[model samples]
Target: MIKVGIVGGTGYTGVELLRLLAQHPEANVDVITSRSEAGQAVADMYPNLRGHYDLRFTEPDADRLAACDVVFFATPHGVAHSLAGEILDKGGRVIDLSADFRIRDPELWAKWYGQPHGAPELLKEAVYGLPEVNREKIKQARLIAAPGCYPTAVQLATIPLLEAGLVSADDIIADCKSGVSGAGRGASVGSLLCESSESMMAYAVAGHRHLPEIQQGLEEAAQSDVGLTFVPHLTPMIRGIHATVYTQLLDDAEVDLQTLFEKRYANEPFVDVMPAGSHPATRSVKGVNMCRISIHRPQNGKRVVVLSVIDNLVKGASGQAIQNMNLMFGLPEATGLNQVALMP
Candidate 1:
């Protein structure tokens, strides 16, 4: 069994990890840490995990964490950097669900995250954990940095066009909306039911942190510096991300956009490229590790619109983390991730 330890097990991603790992045949939840909730039963805090996890939340201890075969950091951005190296040195692989090691450039990370990276040296080695884009690297990675929720939806929608060189990279735009759960389980005025319900508003229009991560992935696909305008909105729902991506086709490029997307994700188990003209709903992917996409070109015009949706906490965070762990351990990529999305 792959002994696993999780840090910050009180958050949404953490519990989501617990929920998924509980059903994983080869995974064992050896330890879970939450500084504030130390000594509390994991189930007490999150009733959904009551029967699945029999462990209690422990304090974040590096030595204890290092003892596991793999450790997942489901904490905030800076938390992973502090202990990932120690775990790696102790022969434990790490999968971080934070922005700490996703961006390669330390300066860019600092600019957006507002602090010097805790482990700049590891930046070079930590593989970006988007399995569709970096599967081979993730399989061999000792440290993995999972992409953010917004970036996951945006990149899945845009990468195929960029890779085929059928779309203009200079003017890409992603107008994305995510549920309140993306803000984390913390108490915030913005996430309050009264504040978010019955309303929709866009924040970070000037600049959102995920912008750089999205650009990084797209630029890699395009193999050039990409000019992208990314805007994120907070929807009133609790668990999904809908990204409406817009890009102009290269002049006179008469490519079959639907076929291109289908072929790009043909073998990817988690990415579902819907039939032509299908409009994928966020709920279709809720609670599952799936990204459903639809392609369109209004009036057969030069501009193309792609709709992408995913359950933010699943594909966007915890479920993807587990997918990376499966790769790192040589397990089937969909081992414990085959659960269907929850439906109304």
Candidate 2:
């Protein structure tokens, strides 16, 4: 069995990783590190995993983590880079679910994250871990950087159009919204039940950190610099992300939305391309690593509307991380991730 270690195993993504890994037959979660919750049973902190994992959380120790074959960094942005070098030096594979190595341009990363990169030399080596787009690269990568939740949903929804040369690269606009759980499992005045419930407001309108990451993916797919205007909003729900994307058609020819989408994601296991005019709800993908998307063509203009939905904590975070791990370990991509959406 492939030994696995998780750094920062108390947050939403970390807990979700534990949930998925517990059922992963080929993998063994040998260590879980948490600064504050060290020495506490993981089940004690998260009652949901009481019977599944009786392991106790430990403090971050590079020497201890180097023993594992693969280590997952579910910590904040700069935290992974601080410790990744030692792990990589020990010939251990790493999958970071943070922004530390996602953006290739170190200057851009510094601009958005508001500090210089901790390890600039390693920036060129980290592979962006979006299986749909970079599966081949992920197979050979020693360090895999998982994509952000918003970028994951938005890119899957619009990339096929950009790659097909069917949409104007400069005219694309993404007005995406995510549930409160995307904010993480932390206590905050803004994330309180009453504060977020019955309220809808847009934040990070001018510049979201995910903007550059999304642009990087689209630019690579289109083989050109793609300009995108991204705006993120917060909803009252507990999970999922819905991205409503608009783009102008490049040519006047008749386009079959369903045919195009179906053909694009035909071999992809987790991406579902719905029939034309079918609206997909968040409940359809909750607790699963599925991205449900549909499209529409308006008569007024050559404008195409696409709706994409995914569970921010699942497809957008931990589940996708596990998907990358599966690829890295030469296991079936769906080996430990064939979970159906948990519906109410």
For each candidate in turn, the TM-score is 0.99, 0.98
What's the residue-level lDDT of 173 in candidate 2?
94
Query: Which predicted model would earn the best lDDT?
Result: 1
Expressed as tens digits, the lDDT of each residue in 12-124 for candidate 2 is 99999999999999998999999999899999999999899879999988988989989999998899987999999988889999999999989999999998999888988
Clashing residue pairs, candidate 2? none
Candidate 1 lDDT score relative to the true structure: 0.93
lDDT of 2: 0.93
**Model 1 quality (TM-score):** 0.99
